[model samples]
Target: MYSLATGFRIPVLQYGLSPTESLLTKINGGALAAAIAAAALSPPPAAWPFGVVGAGAALLNAAPGPRSIARWGAVGYRRLREHTAPASMTAARGETVTWELYPDHGTMQNPAKRASFHAAVDQALRFVSDQARTAGIQVHVTHHAITGDYTTHTQTVSVHIPKGLVASPARVLETLEDEFAGLGALMRVEPEPIPTVTEQGSGWVALDDDRYASTARITGWPPRDDGTLIRKFLLGDERPPRDAARDVVPERSMAVLYRPLTQRRSRWLTRIQEAANGAFTTDPIEKEKIAIESDGRHDAMVAGEVLVDVDAYITVWGHNPDSVSAARWTMTRLADRHRIRLDWLAGQQHRAHVMTSAHAVSTRKGSVL
Candidate 1:
């Protein structure tokens, strides 16, 4: 018997009924049905940032197509499956899986494998949202996919801050780092200490805007405008210095010191200075053209504008592959003839280089966009 109000569809108990269904059976039914109904009526939350615009650093690197967003989700999800599947029901969060089946299925080796990984990310977000919703926390998550081994090399990140529950990159990252009891890959959460934006007054919505949906610039870590969280929400001294993430970054790893438009040049300059002590020449380019192919559902030029202030980035995605790089190179050379910067670098290339997963990868940096 199912109560329309409760959605609790209690299948009439099997076996011989005791003197026909009594008041006990009628009073309680479909408890789970009701909760599922409520969730169905609620809007879907943002799973991750809407997209990574290749804004600054993301622009300078990440190409030849590394992993897709779905691929990244696969990585995180695979680890979750392995860690939680074998645990007891009490230890498992909200998952209904028979934890033992994880290993039995031989799915551990390919955690980031497309099919299973995407499903895992979906389930993880659902569980997190359900738990938080019951506790009065609302979340927004968006998913994006990119190119790669379509397996182990993908990154799930966002600059967009979810409304209601304002958590910083550090906090969210802490949960990520400690998640699965650190059984997964070692993840580093680097929050650049710069004035960033949030959707505080904007409130949550079914669909997000272009600018705010690009990347996660601000988070709840440093605290709201009133200057809290440093001592109270977070324990430490007042007036913590910027570059806190810089200090904590893993030694000799390629990372983008992410920030808004104004800070890219400065950060790039610094990176150039530091890299000078080693190999890789960081020279100033003049009037160069760059070609960007983002797996983003929508290709916005906001990042191009940011780069245009210092260099030119042509949004060349659909052109024939054979001539695309050559065309960009020709443009850079022409610009150089007029004494303009000739360095044409594709941002995606750098991202691919940094995120190289157990492989020595070649890049297309010198190919002129």
Candidate 2:
């Protein structure tokens, strides 16, 4: 099958064999070889080797045999299944249901006006989260700021439904619509069928529907006391997260996963490591002791280091190569403004796009789709 999204060809027999098939093949082949060897034996004493082979074959062919091997294979195969399986093998595999949220108003540059825009966005996210929780769904919501030739800034809530639960993709979307009824913001939910393909290095993956993605690993951020830089990073100084509310948010999205070090032990260790790496190879534990003994100030006691590991991913929907190139350029520029150093994850873009669509939440509505 040819994928409308990525223009990649899907191969037949994508998943070569299942647990039962593999085990049976091994057992049958082993039995055949043992039978041939036994038949070829010149004399009874020469049949010892053949006897051992027959014994091994008996173990594999025994009633309820190969069960142990099959169990182990299943466990190991789960990890490989995602990369080897076809999307259609499961009811709605690799399908995505996304909700795009847009505010009612237009672009506003004034600080006060921007504040109002943010407030509206915050309320919308809260409302959606509350609704999902009530309906027993755990959704992942992300906000994006897209600019350049095509401008769009909006928050998107995505859910991925498993095949076992849902028979049709539209039904899953309808459930979400029911939950999102009466939410003030203009919202649209899209049922997207991802293109499944096997790519070098990435293995099997579902390409985002007519979209390309890039990921950035945030290497550094503004200091703790620098509110200006922090604000700009979170809500760009001139270009707030919702600055382009009036402009359509392209069928594009960006997700920022932030992990902040809050525990005392973790924070101290990170600070010590950073200090040690910046200066000498002296053990951080030893350096802490020396600083405490000499200066009467414990390195861990200092409140200077507040580290957050941020991973940001941007997805852009474009119909052709030229448009895709433009979308990538716009995302690159937007990322630079926040001082976020990034490495494009081109190899895993398709998989990342599917999983990060927040499909983890759709499992709650069993059989609803």
Candidate 3:
């Protein structure tokens, strides 16, 4: 009976269903149906309410017909399964996965070298795109801005791969590496792994192999004409005054997931007008908001450019719980200095993994074109 119930429900359930419940439904449905039918036909027990039992069974079924209870039970179970599904499973259902590409060189600050490096990156991207298309694998590449400062301006590129065409996320990465090698882009590339549920805790779960990552989701400061705050942060500029006794640098990684904004006449006009009012407002905080918006608006207005939505994350890694705890404190302090807010990715274990996950874990997270 459970098999029959599951067979009936499988065609209707769009997502996935559990085998345990299906088996239980098959076992119980026959017995329940028989009991109900037998009760209805038997002489009424003085204390038993036949109408109530029939109505209760009907309500339990929720659907029409004799087998409604069994079918409805399967439907209910499916709903529960979806709500309790693992976050990783939800993420994997997508057509594509995001991978982060990095270069071997420490800082590409020299103009001639930077330009050469960028050129190679462009050539490699174009080559990969063309190759993926020929192979019928759809992909989109996002070019991240590399900051020039007294720090390592690591080249970061986000690659999106359709899971259907590619058997695994690792394959997409292998293809990129091969393309880069072919183009003579002598940089070493590392692909981020998919966040997997390695362990379940009280209220959260661990991700990736390293169970010691201190992660956070940063709400970035508004757009400004001089966006050096974010630029410097990404460039790994560590010039901020710190208490040497308390502040310490640890194994860390940062990711900035952003998209450029395009000019739209109506929206542009509205923002400009808002900034104008903001300029006139007496409140200091309001004025600051206006300044940020105005600067961004003015910057965008120049030659009619686009704005960018930047989502930044900083991860600190350690060898043990104590080290992770200390590194997280330092990372948080640095974030505070930059006027950015950090909300921990909670249960995320690897800084590198979190950084890569940021690249592709959003709806329209990357520029499709």
Per-candidate TM-scores read: 0.19, 0.38, 0.45
In model 3, the runs with Cα more than 4 Å from the true position are: 1-155, 159-192, 200-208, 222-246, 265-299, 345-355, 358-369
TM-score of decoy 2 = 0.38
Q: Give the distance in Å from residue 226's predicted Cα in candidate 3 to where it truly belongs.
A: 6.4
| Model 2, CA-based lDDT | 0.42
Model 2 ranges with Cα > 4 A deviation: 1-99, 104-139, 143-154, 158-191, 195-212, 216-220, 224-252, 257-311, 316-330, 355-369
| Ten contiguous residues minimizing lDDT sum, candidate 3 | 1-10
Q: Clashes in each model (backbone N, CA, C under 3 Å)?
A: 34, 1, 5
Ranking by lDDT: 3, 2, 1
Stronger candidate by lDDT (1 vs 2):
2
Check candidate 3 and list the clashing pairs.
2-26, 61-69, 213-349, 261-306, 261-307
The digit string of per-residue lDDT tens for model 2 on 18-49 reads 33544654765676676677666743445555
Evaluated at residue 164, the lDDT of candidate 3 is 59
lDDT of 3 by residue, 63-102 (tens): 4532245445544454344322233422534344344445
Model 1 superposed RMSD (Cα): 28.1
Candidate topping lDDT: 3
Error of 3 at 184 (Å): 11
lDDT of 1 at 160: 23
